[model samples]
Target: MDKLLITRGVQRSPFWKFILWILPWAMLLAWGLYGAYLCLAEGLNQTNMDNRFAFGLWIYLDLTVIAFGAGAFFTGFLLYILKRHELKSVINSAVVLGLICYSGAIVVLMVDVGQPLRAWFTFWHPNVHSMLTEVTFCLTLYLTVLILEYAPIVMKNRQIRKVPSYLVFEFNLHKLMVVFAGVGAFLSFFHQGSLGGLYGVLRGRPFAFREDLGIWPSTFFLFVLSAMAAGPSFVLLTTWLVEKLSKKRLVKRETMSYLGKLSGVMLIIYILFKSVDTLIWINSTSPSSGFPAFEYYDRAAFGTWVLFAEVVLFGLLPALVLLRKKLRERMVWLIPSAVFVLAGVALNRFVLTIQTLALPTLVFDEFLSYMPSWQEVATFSMVIAYGVLLYSLSFRYLHLFPQERELTQPY
Candidate 1:
């Protein structure tokens, strides 16, 4: 009876319907896999990325997803450390999402690197001063933290729980979850911050350069703050999408509202710091490097609009929208506002990656534009498909939502 009931807990769709739902995503995933093959077999030449733009769409996606994915650690911290009991209702979903985001970013990084087979040379050669090394180290360690945090959820599956030893193991692991969450928080703080530091440390790229605050650049903290601001917003949007697709209330509206409010406050704080950082970069940092601020904007490839789009459209608009009580209460306003927050982060990534490369550092340097080849897009799309597929499977197999059985009482 327990096994039977457990099977029932897994969502049931007609086989044809499941096929229909997954077919398009599956095709896209396959195309991405083919792209991955080309990347591996043919080499890095397959993409538009070059020596100047070594960190292209893949790096942008990795950082943006990981930054947004910080909700996993932050949510875990709230539930396990701070004892915000309300978050327990949605913690599992956060962990699953984090797993997808972090793991997927790692996978993409593996493919994005040249000589992926020799990737370990990063650790072996160890440019200790390089921000990328810190990113690599912390990211991998934090991924372990995420896996550990997620293991108990997998173990809670009725079939798994039925095994007595596994039950005890999971229970023990759950007891130690706070430790794992703490480790995740620690690792997340550094890497998310360091991802921004990656751009900030580029003294050559004045567009990305920032005035140093002690040893770290201002963008370091700004990145972490921006990530925290955007992280919960992404979670809210993802949960809303899941609810729409599944046609069920996964998380209560109150919880969603709380997350939005938190995001709004953080967004405002981040924008303030960002504004300061941008001003400092333009006035003190860029000019010192003998580059005019507006000179970074290319007439053909990048216009001044990128600046307004990132700061105003992506930054202020969503921050203002989500911050308001009346706006947040209205689902119509809130959902798109969360989307704008997402767009802002994505735009942030684009400017950091593409714009940095587009600007000519030397007078002799030529203007450059890069469109991610189909290979790059396909591989990137695979990350989304994989996340969707994993999240779908997790939702079906695990008790992702505590509210599900309570609200629906699936019997």
Candidate 2:
């Protein structure tokens, strides 16, 4: 069968190496599936999560992926709404990554819920005031937008294009893509913000709670800005990884540089707001609630270092590095800076999810910690494996790099 995602003039490794490339991830996938089986067979008893730690590693991974995946919707908005034609080169890969992240998160969420059988109750019961509900509605709807975004790419396959109906449908979808992109951006903005709202509204946890602006907390806007800041960084990192693994230039240096600039600017802005938010929390919110700022940082594992890393090293440092014209243009500096930018977002999610739970709230409560059981780690590994396999398949089949066919031509 003809491949759908291989680049032009690029020859893949031998069948043996191909098998080797997949073997480890495949094993991880199997382990995750086995864990899922146990979870379904035995229930949440297989994991370490308790009533206090109701949202654990699984939720952390889900929200983090969704936040990073914001590149798809944001990039689409730039390309379709703002008419940023230069972004077209990387848009296809962004869409692919978004589809994988969103779908993978939804899958993990299904397993994470206490009553997996009653998962639909979230929608059916409809807790209108709950932040979780808003997350559910937007996530589900935006996932549809991602699917629509990915459809044309799938249809563009050499073999798939041979089907006339598919070709026609693809063309129609392409024409209407602006509308889909608009809907996706709207949904992404809400869901990404709501993920922050998830922690913000937890008034029971002084560490996570925040003062509201109207109905939503300051973290709500901070999350939206943070996700936007990190989204392009993730896309840049993913593309760089793809280029390294494929041993080909998948996108122009200028395009990567532009994305770096965008991410850097947003990161700087986000850091400023985050700093203000932290000061306000420490001075007003925490004090009013009868908790000192140091009280939350009292945990041995989650100390002041987390804050430093998230704010200074991973946050402001990367922003400074990326914003520089000299550094953004150099591949050596560019790749590592992109990595740092991505790390900052991951750290942000970690502080919000794990740190919030790790901090003792009630006077009788003690600092808590959690390590995912083998079952939990396995389930998480499934997502990584799935992403690798999907990206491999897409790279093997789709024209992800527009310059490929032009760069490698037959005489």
The candidate scoring highest on TM-score is 2
Q: Can you write out model 1's per-residue Cα lDDT over 1-411, one digit (the tens) per residue?
A: 333434344454555776688788888899999998899899999998888778778988998899779889888887899998888888898898999999999989999875678878887898889888999999889989888888888888878789999889999999989999888888888998899898888887888888788889988898898888888888889889988887877777888887888788888898888888888877878888898787776566678898888888888988898889888988898888888887888788878887888878888987787789889998999999998888877776678888775555634
Candidate No. with top lDDT: 2
Model 2: how far residue 288 lies from native, Å: 0.8
Q: List the residue pairs that clash in candidate 1.
A: none
Instruction: Give the Å shift of residue 39 in candidate 1.
Output: 1.1
Candidate 1: where is the Cα deviation over 4 Å? 1-12, 409-411
Candidate 2 structure lDDT: 0.87
Residue-level lDDT of model 2, residues 119-152, one tens digit each, is 7788899989988899999998999889998999
All candidates: CA RMSD (Å): 2.2, 1.8
Query: TM-score for every candidate vs. truth?
Result: 0.94, 0.96
Candidate 1, after superposition: displacement of residue 347 in Å?
0.5
